[model samples]
Target: MGAAVTPHVVDSHHHVWDLSVRDQEWITGEALAPIRRDFSLTDLLPEARAAGVTATVLVQTVTVAEETPEFLALAADSDLVAGVVGWTDLTRPDAADALARLRQLPGGQHLVGIRHQVQGEPDPQWLLRPDVRRGLAAVGAAGLAYDLVVLPHQLPACVKAAQDHPELTFVLDHVGKPPVASGAIEPWATAVRMLAGLPNTVCKLSGLVTEAAPKTWTVDGLRPYADTVLEAFGPDRLMFGSDWPVCTLVAPYGEVLDVARQLTGSLSDGERAALFAGTATRVYGLRLSEGS
Candidate 1:
């Protein structure tokens, strides 16, 4: 809709949160307080529209047990949110029971996946522990996914999580939160390659600019990592995401998508379509049935 260069777009990652409801410990005093206010589907739709993104997957902002049902309710009434990645008590013994409960929510049909705040843990092996493995297995059995939200230093844990649970689909967030502004690439790229080697894995091209210094990030600043994801996962396993509201710290939604479009100019059209929209529809089961 924005231009003829691309068709429809399905953003695979973004978050909606209200400080009145809960606090995001990750956003502290000085850096990103501007986003502390509630960012719901209303605040997000305009930004996504400017970027030519039709629908998005609402990601869980907190690890609290109540938040998943909250997101499911929001997605159930909203059209812009095509799906959701909620959270569950991965280490709890009742994880399988918890997954069943999640399915009973009104918006559970939009619950394509689940996530835990693994980045908060100091131990990189947290995902591989026996109890956590059980939780991931429950997700795979329920036909849901687990998303990895970790720092680059924690990528080995992501690798372990993917390698150990070959049945669970793993979607890496923010290109492993790489240090793009500093131009640091080594172990990050190498780890990405290792994770991409897994057959059940996919990666989201989201939340990159926030990792770089705000406003100063150029398309080139994001290219190496973007190119790395595309090269490592190929088009079929990669999906685009705006990571909105949090991305407001870097640039507006339209400019961020411009960075993505420019950075991805080298890929063929079919590959671009997959990253922009096709992969999301397939992975999240967004293909609708016959007409109403």
Candidate 2:
């Protein structure tokens, strides 16, 4: 708990995208314009260095089919990117082949997992679909994981999906995005507990800072969900993430880590290290040197 187990940490979640290359189609407001300009390895590394984050996992920000190789190429050129969780169509018949193609791309060795923005899907059971289950199985067979980026309401489907494929690793992003902004918890907490009961699933202690009043959220604002996830998933299944640039929308990168440290102050040293860095390294197969 002393000083939050400060280490030369690894930020397990963060992203870099360029709208000039192709419109993200997700950044639609002035609040998001700073990122729309261009966020690449060059833009992220300095900030990460200044904040003491030595390595990062570059996550998928767009759902486009081609973005995986684009992210892989970016990884090949940088040391900061320790792993890449790019995307592929999980619903396609050739989903397994598509995943194989992504691995052949440059820097694809850095590829650790597959993610489709399940939160964007209108049908809650989309993840539970038979074809989607086949694709997830393929990912598991290939020794890759699947990340669950879903809304709170989608937790039931996520739980079903996780149980349906116990061999596939599943990561829950943003604390399943609880309604901390509105102070509501009932069903979200219930569903999250259910999802956590699955042995193959883990949750990211990230993206919560932006879920509250950006300028005003305190450790208290994040505490309930953080504590719940800690209790539900325990140290082994929970990992830290910065959720950067998007975090810039609410708090700076350091502040996000600061809050994470503060909320987890009661844990043992090993637990803190796991949440802050160890778990991510194991979960993502990050290639780290002493410098990283």
Total colliding residue pairs, candidate 2: 0
Could you estimate the TM-score for every candidate?
0.95, 0.96
Task: Tell me the tens digit of each residue's lDDT in model 1 across 1-292.
Answer: 1222567788888898888888888787877878867888888888777766777888998878889899999988987887889999988999999999988989888889988888888888888889999999999988888899998888988898898888889999888999887889888999999999999999998888889877587777787898899899998999888888888888888877877787778777898898888887777766432210
Give the runs in model 2 whose Cα sits over 4 Å from its true position.
1-3
Model 2: residue 120 alpha-carbon error in angstroms: 0.9
lDDT of 1 at 172: 91
Where does candidate 1 stray beyond 4 Å? 1-4, 287-292
Residue pairs clashing in model 2 are none
> Whole-model lDDT, candidate 1?
0.84
Tens digits of per-residue lDDT for model 2 on 141-259?
88887888999889999999888898988989888989887878878999999999989999999999878876677788789999999999998889989898898888887788888
Return the lDDT, model 2, position 276.
81
- Tell me the whole-model lDDT of each prediction, alpha carbons only: 0.84, 0.87
